[model samples]
Target: MSGVDFEQVMQAALAADAGVAGIVSRRIFPLSAPKGAPLPFITYQRVSGAPEAVLDGDAPCERISIQIDAWAKTYGEAKRLAKAVRGVMAGAEFAAELDEDRDLSDEEARVCRVSMDFIVWA
Candidate 1:
């Protein structure tokens, strides 16, 4: 909706859990991470969605999709961070739903990554 401020949604995401904070050290990237940044951090981006028609000057409800990813040196650490994220997003103020989670490991890079997809209605 044009009247709906998506900043509030971002704030809710940042306030999800203290455990998530501890893991990422408050590093939540809306874009890209800095060069040579350390591991065990979080990154998120808003995915594109279909356009909705607005009728009678009434703003249509917003359906926002976000992908949150956690990168760590160990699989267990990544899983823990992902779990914390899930716990917080599940109780967000908005109607947020966790769609899926994909966990990956990079043996060459010696890192584990967990990606979580979420849809929030505003």
Candidate 2:
């Protein structure tokens, strides 16, 4: 991951995919979305990562854990967004290989959320 723009690549991948962009429209963000932003947006962050170790040193590739949160006003929309993310990133080996996911709500905000975790060799 050294010297790589992880967030930029991730953002591009999401934004370029029609399945994701049709809903979010490049609203994908790193770490968090802006305050009071629009609904059905997305936020992603690196939960954990490690260099691919070799017998003597680090390798170019890495093992990374990425978490993506899809937020919307309806539970259905959140789930749809997760599916799109999983589809678009399947080749990237990130969002596709979902190890865990949960449907949630923000009581105060009254919004639906689907949080998913995926681990992959990036």
Candidate 3:
């Protein structure tokens, strides 16, 4: 898939996750060029209703970590964008991490990192 395609997939997947009311905010970081560097990170915090499993004690508060290195063209750019995006999510109720080692296919190279955070209940 192309970088744009990868980004769309990631966004769609996150938006469709269970218990997500809506995206409170979103940020994109443009990274420097270089492969294998950390990509921009995206975090989404829940807006309402606790995870059913968490309430039932069947599972802890749902913490999801999704890494999308497919949209970056270089390692430096990915890392830079990841950090920049994470900065955007600072003080958010949710947390996320960007994996630096992963690289998307050539077609999936882009220049920005996307991060979001959602709070289930706050």
Candidate 4:
């Protein structure tokens, strides 16, 4: 997928899950970069031999994985945000995984690797 598409999905996920206003604060890497970077890279692919109703996937029953780095003002706050995000995402029929990492600086910012599979229902 394109970088713009990735950003939109990330922002939507953050807003739907955490109720937070999200912007593409950083454009550190490409949307489809495979390696030569840190973990939690956002990736997308079309599924083959799938039905026609699927959005990103080739088949209607298929889905694509989305990954993003999430940050918050504090670790506790980040965790809370991640939990809220997951809760809301579940209702949207998206499976999400939130991985949190502590920020070394005093800025109280932490990164969360959020992933979900996008599926278009009938």
The digit string of per-residue lDDT tens for model 2 on 15-121 reads 89898999999788888899988989999998998989999999877777889999999999999999998877786534446778899999899999999887767
Cα lDDT of model 3 by residue, 1-122, tens digit:
22333334444444344322122123322232244544333333322243336454755344343333223445555555444444433323343333323333344455443333322211
Q: Which ten residues in a row have the lowest lDDT in candidate 2?
A: 88-97
Model 4, 1-122: lDDT tens digits are 33334335544555543244332222223345434543322333322223356467565233334333333344455455445544544465334333332322243323344333333222
Better of 2 and 3 by lDDT: 2
**Which scores greater on TM-score, model 2 or model 4?**
2
Which segments of model 2 are wrong by more than 4 Å?
Answer: 1-3, 93-96
Candidate 1, which segments miss by more than 4 Å at Cα?
1-8, 50-60
Against the reference, the lDDT scores of all candidates come to 0.76, 0.84, 0.36, 0.39
Would you list the rank order by TM-score, best first? 2, 1, 4, 3
Question: Weakest 10 consecutive residues, lDDT, candidate 3?
Answer: 19-28
Model 2: clashing residue pairs? none
What are the models' TM-scores?
Answer: 0.80, 0.90, 0.31, 0.39
Best-performing candidate as measured by TM-score? 2
* Candidate 4's TM-score: 0.39
Model 4's lDDT to the true fold?
0.39
Per-residue alpha-carbon lDDT of candidate 1 for residues 51-74, written as tens digits (9 for 90 to 100): 455766635666778888888999
- Collision pairs in model 1: none
lDDT of 2 at 26: 77
